[model samples]
Target: GAERQVRLPLGCHHPLVPLHLHEERPSYVVCGGAVFTALSQPYLQHEWGKAWERRAPVSLVAKALNGSKAQRGEQVVLLSQLLGHECVRGYDSALLANSMVRALNGVPILCLAQLAQLVLACRQRSLRFDLEESRVLVLDTAQARGAEAEILQQHNIPEPVLINERDAALLR
Candidate 1:
């Protein structure tokens, strides 16, 4: 009989697995008073403790149980944390955490790298972030740019943004 071969879909093992995980390249981005990162099982576990599946938000648990990549090189980018700043005033509610980012500047966000690019290259007067559950976050572009350095310093974040080269290339 002739040799038989089968190919399985990539990232089929786990729905919450991050698209990119590397030491040199960070999987997170900090900009405009928000921390963006890809959703992963470890993050869920860390945030929700040992009983993450049960303790975590129902929306997240549902994604973990049944979510799949709709397109190649896709990642579940999320607003992991919100920093206090005038640029992001009135959005300090804790409910914003772990909310999946739907789009930035009306462009769909596929990965963390893409989100970073959208933020850094935006020339509009404001940066709009569309999130899950009909939540919308808008920040003044000039204020955000000007406040980023101060926000980083206050939080002691070394870099404003860090993204994997491979992930960045995928968007291009």
Candidate 2:
């Protein structure tokens, strides 16, 4: 992906951030549920689908950035700009742990662009998209079957133009 400048809105009061996948052990949370080293693409989609069904508000969901308090703080600022919401909240410890904690508490954590993709899916039934990393998408039995290909085709996403071996395997 091409790097681009990001600007926070006038009242957002946070640093600009890039929309990139973050990987770091420090940011890793000890989520109290079934923890897999990696989650599949379909799993992630189903999780997002569920969130949409449950009406999880994107405004309050803290983004997963490079594992740091400051970067995490920047998420709200970025979100305020993206979602056009004013009066943003600062990062909460609980929200910071949301992705993992949700898994522990039996809700799938939609990581990376999964949440955004799911939101897009609700409005547009067909579109193409890319996922930079594998995220654990929690779903029930019915929702789990054949979700990845269907979602990818709906979004017109092709095989990645650039990917490392690890990520390639995860996507497959």
Candidate 3:
């Protein structure tokens, strides 16, 4: 018999892949009532509990099982949650939770850091989030900007945006 090697597709489920963590660097960004962050195994586990594979969103689970990094530093950024605010009136948070963010203001989103930068630097009248499944979330730029502080204050959040210096610098 001859010895043979087999390779399995591990994607983000690979043990060697580092999980994004807030302790290492700011893993989330709060902008215009939306909380954005990269997808991680821990997040899925936390959201769905011990039986995450059975309870988690099928799409997310598929990503975890089948997704692979396409480029260096690539991440699957998602709109993890939403905060109630006038800026986001009438939008159902449940429908948007855990939705993968594909783009913002027509610019593709690569990572949480880049998404943060885009939201902050947009000079347009509106900010548009192109999410998975052809879903769109539009917000008035001026209203979102003005309400950001109030949203944070109301929600008792200390910071509106937080990203590791290295990640931020890479974008610049």
Q: TM-score for every candidate vs. truth?
A: 0.84, 0.21, 0.83
RMSD of 2: 18.3
lDDT of 3: 0.81
Tens digits of per-residue lDDT for model 2, 1-172: 9999999767443322223334421111111111122222223233455453234334222232222224331222111111111111232323232233232123233332332223223332222122122222222222222343443344353421223333323223
Ranking by lDDT: 1, 3, 2
Which digits, one per residue and each the tens of the lDDT, describe model 1 over residues 1-172?
8998989777445444553355445478887788998776767887898798899888887777678777777878889989887777789549888899999999999888889888989999998999999998888888888988899999998889877675576577
Kindly report which residue stretches of model 3 are placed more than 4 angstroms away from their true locations once superposed.
Answer: 1-26, 165-172
Summarize candidate 3's per-residue lDDT along 1-172 as a digit string, tens digits. Answer: 9999999987543321234454565467887898887787778877998787799888888787677767656677889888998778888899999999999998998777889888989999999999999988899999988988898899998888877664565465
Local distance difference test values of all predictions, in order: 0.81, 0.27, 0.81
Candidate 2 global TM-score: 0.21
| Residue range with the least summed lDDT across 10 consecutive positions in model 2 | 77-86
Which ten contiguous residues of candidate 1 have the minimum total lDDT?
Answer: 11-20
Model 1, stretches more than 4 Å misplaced? 1-16, 19-26, 165-172
Please rank every candidate by TM-score, starting with the best.
Answer: 1, 3, 2
